[model samples]
Target: MGDVEIRPARSEEYAAAGEVTVRAYDVDGHLAGDVGYDTVLRDVARRAEQAEVLVAVDGAGEVVGTVTVVLPGSDFAEISRPGELEFRMLAVAPTARGRGIGEALTKAVLDRARTLGIPKVVLSSLEGMRGAHRLYERLGFARLPERDWRPFPHISLIAYQIDV
Candidate 1:
């Protein structure tokens, strides 16, 4: 209900953002109960340089959500071309749901993509995340055929593309 600000993440905020990721995924049983803490830490370190990580902070400056946009790279080879931006991770604090934080973060990404002259933004969402799917659909993203995309671990991913 207070002011929500989205900005480029600072190096010191990685740990907090990781915590948000763990808690968000854990709520849906996507992560193991004993998932290692260092796992996210290492991931943050590895991807920080190659991605644009944005954190949403509340009026008090507490991190409440995070989204990472990874430009087309070796890891994002599934994307067709250079004009597309890939959204890697998007997580909102469980307590922050329904507050428009997720939508704000998503808009920030799209805004950045437009500023960078990217034509489209692509993201993969787990099939079970119905609310997230709806959000994407509301934002003008359509479901791409499964045959056109592939995500990891055999978990079917619903792909969405939004023109910037």
Candidate 2:
């Protein structure tokens, strides 16, 4: 595995994170049809102030992956329960896949959740992302019953919860 450093995303790194997000979700051109690059960047930037946005930087200091953890708030209505944190917008660069960057980012988020005394972490993934689904399951996340809370249209989402 390459030397990976996971850290809280800085405002300057928003562009890099946006690039990674676009590339990672470009699988079969799904994200492009739903959300453009500017929208993703704007949304991520807005969320950074309230939530923890972590980025995985390579040895060269380039961001190759990112994950956002949302604390309980009005923005995350899907997670109505208490003592839980929500994760969203997880993405790894195409070249950075299989290099443990995603796992490292996830571990960082879970670590922070534990430090915050949050008992569980929740996330919703696109139904077709089988690899991501498998990784979440391997990391002890259980699939919850289907819900109608997805933000995107024509996309089926599977919710998962993991105890921190």
Candidate 3:
């Protein structure tokens, strides 16, 4: 409840970070109870080995949020292109919403992009996630409908991009 810090998730914190991810998605009805994607979210360890897993910890040291940042060509890079860094699985624990943890975690990724001299950052979000969309907009991300796509018939992903 004091201050939250966003940083890379340690190997031992991967499972907990994954749990945060699923809980956030479930509360939003994005992929609640979907074992396939839930398992994917919980596999932060695999993500850490491939991309980067960032976690938000409360002043008390509890893991309250997580997001996965993918390099341009990583397997997790769904919508990122050259000179861009893409992030996904941005989730704040349901109990932790409205605490600015989500913003902080997102800003962390943006900050990294700046440091790496990346020209832009992009991501895909499920439709109807108004709160998340608001956050993206507030951070200067613009809708990239031209890039919005559906990987599967049942799942729609809207794209957003911000020049860093």
Residue 81 CA displacement from its true place in model 3, Å? 0.6
Return the TM-score for each candidate structure.
0.87, 0.89, 0.96
lDDT of candidate 1 over 39-117, digit per residue (tens): 7533655567777788999998888898888787645335535788878668888988889988988999999998899
User: What lDDT score belongs to each candidate, Candidate 1 first?
Assistant: 0.77, 0.79, 0.90
Between prediction 2 and prediction 3, which has the larger TM-score? 3
lDDT of 2 by residue, 1-164 (tens): 45888888998998889778877888535475564544754466876876778999888889999988888774633553678888888899998898988888877878988998989888887778888888888999888765435665676677888898
Clash pairs (backbone) in predicted model 2: none
Best of the candidates, lDDT: 3
Poorest lDDT segment (10 consecutive residues) of candidate 2:
33-42
Q: Which candidate comes out best when scored by TM-score?
A: 3
Q: Which is better, 1 or 3, measured by lDDT?
A: 3
Please give the ranking of all candidate structures by lDDT, highest first, separated by commas: 3, 2, 1
Would you give me the overall lDDT of model 2?
A: 0.79
Off by over 4 Å in 2: 35-38, 146-148
Per-residue error for 146 in candidate 1, Å, reads 4.8
User: Per-residue error at 115 for model 3, in Å?
Assistant: 0.8
Cα misplacement distance, residue 29 of candidate 1 (Å): 2.1
